[model samples]
Target: MNYLKPSETLSELFAGLVVVLTVTLAASVLGGGDEAGATTALIGAIGANTAWGIIDASLYVMNATFDRKRQLRFVHVIAASPDEATALDQIRGELDPILESVTKAGDRDQLYRSIYSTLAHGEFPARSGLQRDDIVGAIQMFCIALCATLPAAIPLLLSSHPMQALRISNFLVVGLLFIVGYYWAKYVDVNRWFAGLGLMSLGLILVGVAIALGG
Candidate 1:
């Protein structure tokens, strides 16, 4: 399975919604102009999500570019070899450790395959295949780190009642948080509800403090 599928990115994107929702709710509870607070929360959430997505996309692009360059060097050495078998074998020996290291550093399976296919005449020369579960799991983690703010953005922007809107946004955020946390717990093979709620609560508290401070 591809380690960075659209589904994976989507899951994280949903998780980001949770972050926005939770913050919006907190801001409301702290008291502020309903329309203005909601608008602020909305703006903040959208900004956060965009920033996170750009970061993830940037990492993928940068890493792929770097890996492709390295692969080119390998291809050159292998091509120049007198014996194809020996050259391929030598490259294989060197590539395995490198592949493993890249996997460990981040889920580089998809990027590597792209580079390999481009250079190897459409042949994907991946020595290892990533499990579907691993890719989904990594995406889930990435979302937990990035997407928890989607719900908050709308509330901040549209709520006429600032406090109410903020509260609504907070509740929505908490709910999304629980959803992401539950999925994350399941991915890690842990207690789902407890882990999920625990994470949601922590996020809520942090945002609550920020709202109290007029953030």
Candidate 2:
């Protein structure tokens, strides 16, 4: 399914890494860096990520359905409008959020008119319902969220020393945060290194806050 955008994938991974870091750090703070602490952290990370993945998947399905309905509604509204101006207005309202910042009013109007022309001739959907593509996208969302736990979780499992394992896990998650941010910057036109370091710093700050707040 061509459903999961790069931005969405990056967002899930970024959030998941922050959550894992926060959970592990809180466990270490509360459990005193013992075997128990490592065990608690590992379980917490797994459970949190799994739940988050499921939640995101559910939301993906919901959004897919809702978006379909919205599209149909949009088409109907365009078809029902009394004249071209109203239909153009409807299209402008829809396009404004995306084009407002980067484009001039004239450019947006041209784009809106172009879209209006196409939509005027397009047929509205007879019905809206969930499809296979939606399900596939949901599964993709879930997989991305769940897989995000692996880099940190594997290190925790591999080391015999609990403190060392926790340290390694933190390091791995920070690196993952940096990597995600580096890719994220590509879309935003930011300096890659700065974005990477900034995300890592933000992740650490969030974990620290979680620990301080008693997790």
Candidate 3:
């Protein structure tokens, strides 16, 4: 099961990388030493980011499942409506955006019937019985986050100078954040350069917060 779209994978990768770098940088600043326990810092960053990614992805899955249930309930309600016109109106209100480009009357009618039938029969026609896509998406998110940890940590693990390693990690993360933002903007039809700057600023803000809180 393919869990993540290509764009989503990139977004998660950069986000996780920024988070790991921010926290590690904050830790280095607070501890104030050239060799401020690089091994412990590396392990801590990896562990913290991995756990956070898993938790975040789990929450997303729960919310998505709840949303799916809500959509099904809405469909069931529409199907139970006494008037066909009213049911069609409800469907239009809920699904018009998705079906806007589908101009064929037969196609629209067929789609409405399919939805009504699926809801009435309690068949919930998802891709998999257990929502495999959602599960896979969560796992993909977790893996992206876990993998991001290594890049930020490798410098800390290898270098004797904590500040230098932190600086390098910060630069790498900042650059990645800009790239992530640029692509995200392009995906959403916005100004790519501005979005890149915005994301980089957001990363800086997060780093500032981490430092202020003594990470």
Candidate 4:
């Protein structure tokens, strides 16, 4: 049920943050320095990112559903065997990597029986049931994406000068991207400084593209 681990959540948070920041900065730049322009930029960025987040989360849920169906099919195949011994053999053969550490005969037998019963009865056991975690993870992802818009939009919402707001938002986002990249690299056992710079460069590229496209 663990659809997304803590590290994955952090990585997603940073990625979403950078994306929203770039878009908001572009919006601020394109709009003129006025109350109406600032309001438009802030509202546009928030609304766009919110919609994107929902769409992204929905796709994740759909993909997870398909994947779960595939896994159930595999289970059905194993349960279709004629005899207990054959079923166990099939399970061991197909899922050896998963059961390799289960050295105890009793444990293996329990696992085999559990899988066979669940598939044969068309009732998945608690642990093997449809994962609620996927739905929860999707919601969390959506929230992260939506929340990311706020930081970039804050300056635009508060400041009268669109250009000044854009500059501050750009700087804030770049700094955040570097910090996220550094920690992410450390988590993955990579070179932190290089990763930081790399992500920062990527952010800049995205900003350029957004501006060129007249976002």
Among these predictions, the greatest lDDT belongs to 2
TM-score of each: 0.52, 0.87, 0.79, 0.71
The per-model lDDT (C-alpha) reads 0.58, 0.85, 0.74, 0.73
Runs of candidate 4 with Cα error greater than 4 angstroms are 1-3, 81-131, 213-215
Root-mean-square deviation per candidate: 9.0, 2.4, 3.5, 4.7
Candidate 4 structure quality by residue, lDDT tens digits, 155-203: 7767767777877776777787887778778677889999889887887
Question: Going through the candidates in order, what is the number of backbone clashes in each?
Answer: 23, 0, 0, 0
Give the winner by lDDT: 2 or 3. Answer: 2
lDDT of 3 by residue, 1-215 (tens): 55677776776776686678767776666656456555556777788888878886897588668877877678677868877677777887788778778667678877887776666565654532248678878887888888888767777777778778877766777787788788888677889999999888887787788667765
Q: How close is candidate 1 to the true structure, as a TM-score?
A: 0.52
Q: Is candidate 2 or candidate 4 better by lDDT?
A: 2
Global Cα lDDT for candidate 4: 0.73
Score candidate 4 by TM-score against the native.
0.71
Off by over 4 Å in 3: 5-11, 97-129, 213-215
Error of 4 at 25 (Å): 3.0
lDDT of 1 at 211: 59
